[model samples]
Target: MGKKYSDIKEKLQIVVDKKTTNDLAHLTHYFQNHKNGVSQCFRSSATEYLSELHEELNIAEEPNFQYYLPIKWDIPFPPTENPTFKFIDLFAGIGGIRLAYQNNGGKCVFTSEWDTYAKKTYEANFGEVPFGDITQISEKDIPDHDVLLGGFPCQPFSIAGVSKKNSLGRKHGFLDETQGTLFFDIARIIKHKKPKAFMLENVKNLVSHDKKKTFKVIISTLEKLGYNVHFKILNGKHYVPQNRERIIIVGFKKTVFKSKETFEFPDPQESNFVFKDILEPKVDDKYTLSDKLWNYLQEHARKHKAKGNGFGFGLTDLNGISRTISARYYKDGSEVLIPQKGKNPRRLTPRECARLQGFPDKFIIPVSNNQAYKQFGNSVVTPLIQAVAKNIVKELSKINESNQSKIAVHK
Candidate 1:
């Protein structure tokens, strides 16, 4: 009998643990997608990896060599059995955007993330390991899909990114070839695959980066690819108890929507969540700040205040929203710190960070606390992404229905 995901899950990891390449990503992705049309994209590589594993382990395969059984989908976030549309996730940080699209009836055919710790967390919850280094992956290698979803690397255009780069006498934005060119990879894939629609999420500062020139180039490039682009700055505060803002860029193929797609970004929902809503009733004492660190934070805040600067640790109001949680949150937890009754304010526990990003309690955090904090801090507010994805999917359905009607009339 072919092995189920559960049957060989440990063996596969053993194989993965022994590898230095990204072949395990292919193997896991193939196991998840084999029965679907998406498998062809991964089969050759996955099969080779599986064969190597079987030989090394001295396990005899069936005469025909059944690489996998129908996947049991025993992971925390399995793919939908019957998907309404397909999408690809780029820069998929721990599957935040993936969850949003999946909830909206979209199947993720491909996903890529380069971070080792983030990939571990993603595979733990989603069952499939993601391909790494999107820049090295060819556009033609990606599967065709209805939508492309990416919360692309934003540090190149963020305020903090620019400030740090300036201090180090380094380039930021488009001038930073190391990271800035990643957007072109997204554009390259879009131009090749020509998905019906796409959604990109980035730091709010992206709109004003390089004096708006960078944003202008991005918009113009999509237009040149024959897409009708619409974008807006949306805040997570409306969905989560955090005042985080990001720019969402949506594009539809002009040939598909004819510049007449009736798509609109979702209006901000009511802010019903508060800081305490996501906080744990009982947190470990280790999360509490050290007296030395607390005193240093206080003195640092005083000096910044004296200099007329707004830089300081934010002691969150239990009943109110918090400042934006950031990837640097793990360093000092200065952006959003919880107050204690008698002790120094504490950093948010890893689980609390996940909750703040609208992740469910069932979501697994298999990484270290520091890595978990960074992953969640870099993630999207799930409910907010879902709200927007709902609208996008609705429009895609309408477009499909219209196309079907045209075909029926012609027949």
Candidate 2:
């Protein structure tokens, strides 16, 4: 016969006293009244008591203890079959692309973003911190993925930059700038990974940056790397309440490329929102603009209006669309101004800023209001990305089906 209850209890008590004093004392008190000696009956009761205690504590049994483990409730593992297509998010920002793809049944295998604040927000929402500085990472170190997505830095090719390329022949297209020239890193990775597809986002100016030369170079580069590239300018107002405009570029690996499909960017939906849509009804003193600054803006707008120039700030109405929200919005409330009851114009609150960019309320905004403004201003509109991703997935599925048919015939 196996060891008796009382005998096991005595041995366990010695072990417990040495390893866990307080728990042993309490356990011994509960079993102290049992009259059975070191016999099978005592051993059976000790096992039951310990098992019940384990249950109450919600502790997982060690794998080595499986043979002695008692029956208990089990947690169902998440289904892995028919798993979603996996992609990596480069220059992830706040995971705008990741959110878009995830909503469409795609999974993120890896993400990289250098900004610490954006990474914090990305982790808060996606439960994963993005790796930093893509340029420092090796191509071989990246995991295998079917898709690659990024809104790589746009500063090098932005209208604000000097020595900008004016054509595909110029090196300044993306490879020449030192401050924010990271696109070639993306090119190298794509050359090696040969993902089925990739999507890139940038400012609208990128298309016309250098008399169409910049855009031409990008398209030709991807072609040389064996990809069928398609690109278009998409507006956020089409999918959200904001009037932000951006360029979306997509490509399919040359090996998997097929007959081109018409890439229709989603059209703007009827939006009834104005600057008022993102305003706070109750004004906080912190948000109230200084009378001096307000006077300066008003005078500046008047001067610009006199010159027939729309370059200066203007008060937006409650029923009209807003001007584009720029990264410089943090500097002054000049781009999009709101009409106030008796106070000066105020900048949009961080929450309102997030909403303007089509960020869901569940999205985390863990940074300061200024950082939030910059982040959303830089992020791609989620809905627009989703619409474009849908088209890419559709085209890829067709290619995959064709390949399957060919395989079947050969077999």
Candidate 3:
């Protein structure tokens, strides 16, 4: 049985003092029922106690904290007195990042994607198809925009590719791999256009890729391009019900705005999401795997267990978050297995896959189930992107306000 409220309170008081009787009551109830673990309970209780302390001390809220609260990082940017900031979507896989920025009142001046099927889905939803082959298109051909966004290809730096490339004796850095070389294209565009800011997303392994040399080069190259670079590893589980980790890099054009301080990534919000919250009750029969495949998976699990490698598919319960979905999900749905009744395990429907990535029901999926699975598995979480975009807009607003103030002083 769980500990009683009074016993828990007594234990908590040793670390947290100065709580009123009413505050303690609320905190005790919170701990007994909250979905998160003790750490969350402690953090929430501490926050509530701190607020009360602030009132007692007559201290004002910090400027950043005041601005941070109540701003739904998940929602798009609020309308501004300044005209809507323009942004371009690069490597726009089905426009996940594009939707986040668009929801925030930012306009897309250009979009680029090389995948034909992804282009179809993107156009079906966004009303305009992305131009093909960013490598072929010059920076001058692209329209001017305040921001740039992309989750560049991750194949080259991935463990799978590194192993293959090392055997071939080809160059291993970003410049050698087909997808790795694309960063040069992004850097060249930034050098020429100098957008107010840009955001790049990639797998978390990118930080430690090639024993840190790969990351060091990326940083130094962007710095030479005259931008202040900031990066953080953000997890999708914080905003959505999936455990996907990615590195987000934000760069500010030094000529437009100069700041010595680093940008702070948004704090993790309370997550109430679960697998059941996104599942489709009446999925098509095609998504259900056959008994033969199910048996194979069980046998695979046992074999891998003997060898000490995890070969079995990961099964996510209705009450918990999901593991990361990958492009190979279409080939074998091995990463995200759903439970079935007295039968073989099943794969999530295409629509369920979309929901896992935070795509709304209204977002059209014009491709085949296999294609849909691959696309969403490769996409970003809209809420996560939207929240980070909000922070970027806030910083840009400051720069705009500062410019106006300087003009007024001159007058």
Candidate 4:
């Protein structure tokens, strides 16, 4: 009953309003989920957004707001058709994880990200603008999903608060330990939604952060939530030309898997890739380091080498994997620099960075080069993520099949 997304999208381009950004997000998300049984989660707000847009533009034609229209998606990654399972994306940076899961037959019913530039790139590729700031959104507003996915940032738990709570004989569970941090938002949502499975990604250093207290609390928190938690530190080199290592934490609901889950992290495979595999043939001269900066970097390396410190710029070997690409790579490209034939070392182009992270060429980049660096640096290895997601989906399918057979026998 609702108007076509293409028609409203054309009208939205001519509007000069800034506050309507969030409204457009609702409209897109509503339309994206219309056939997925989760449209009700966004229907009310989307209906209101369309009505106001029509009024402000003073369009003579009255549009019916009932249900979804058959939309021909113009985006690179449209919503999956007849998805076997549903998931929600939190802290979804440019949808790297969502892509892997979507490729595994999982439909993303809801997504939330806080950055403005990242949202633009996400919308350009997925055709749905993510809701901003997960901290501001309530858990109940999110649709019911089979799995939850997030790559959340974490802060150290306050020791003083823990001592004070213990002294007062108060229960200091995950809600107390993870409070005042982004992980708390994730914990709270899991406590409310009770999804069958969940996956979280973080820097490998998290395993030893705050002397391992942080990781212990995280595991215990999930245990208290009635889920069997499994974790591993996985390297991206198994699937990409980058040596990025991240910690993946996975959980399965005890009620569903019955505490007998046999989930195993994917074994690392031999890497057939090298640094040169992701290089661009004809890069612009601007990517090359300037003469002055190049000399300064050499001097910096010499000083650190003399002192036996490993804090120097990395000039990657063409035949080997490169160092981890970081979000701060846009600053100086010091971590993973490429060697040049007759000049100073150069930085990886945005497209090369995308390939290093296993992102496909068709993925759109609607932001500046600096923003692209940050987004790609902060993203996961898509092929590696897809490998893990395939296992998760396969496990869920087996469980669902077993349950169906039991019901059939009972009947």
lDDT of 1 by residue, 323-364 (tens): 999999999999999998888999999999999999999999
> How good is model 2 by TM-score?
0.74
Least accurate stretch of 10 residues (summed lDDT) in model 4?
153-162
TM-score of each: 0.97, 0.74, 0.77, 0.90
Instruction: Name the best candidate (by TM-score).
Output: 1
Clashes of 1: 0
Which regions of candidate 3 are displaced past 4 Å?
1-83, 160-176, 260-262
Q: Residue 363 in model 1: shift from native, Å?
A: 0.7
Between which residue pairs do clashes occur in model 2? 4-39, 4-40, 5-39, 5-42, 5-43, 7-38, 167-213, 168-213, 226-254, 238-268
Better of 2 and 3 by lDDT: 3
- Give lDDT tens digits, candidate 3, residues 201-295: 98888889989888889889999999889999999898888999889999998878765434577888889998889988687777778877778
**lDDT score of model 3?**
0.74
Per-residue lDDT of 1-411 in model 2, one digit per residue for the tens? 223333433334323111332233223322321222212322443456567656765647632223232212111211112434768889988888888887767766656777777865765565444656788777876657778998988766666443434443545545565634687788899999889889999988788866888778787888888887878887888665567778888988766665365555566566655656666567567766788888888898889889997668756666776777766677776777776777777777777777777777767687887888888877887888998888777776777787889999999
Candidates sorted by lDDT, best first: 1, 4, 3, 2
Off by over 4 Å in 2: 1-83, 161-176, 260-263, 272-275, 280-283, 303-309, 403-411
Off by over 4 Å in 1: 1-4, 14-20, 63-67
Clashes of each: 0, 10, 2, 0
Please list all clashing residue pairs in model 4, or write none if there are none.
none
Compute the lDDT of residue 32 as modeled in candidate 4.
Answer: 84
Model 4 residue 86 CA deviation in Å: 0.2
User: What stretches of model 4 exceed 4 Å from their correct place?
Assistant: 1-8, 14-21, 65-68, 154-180
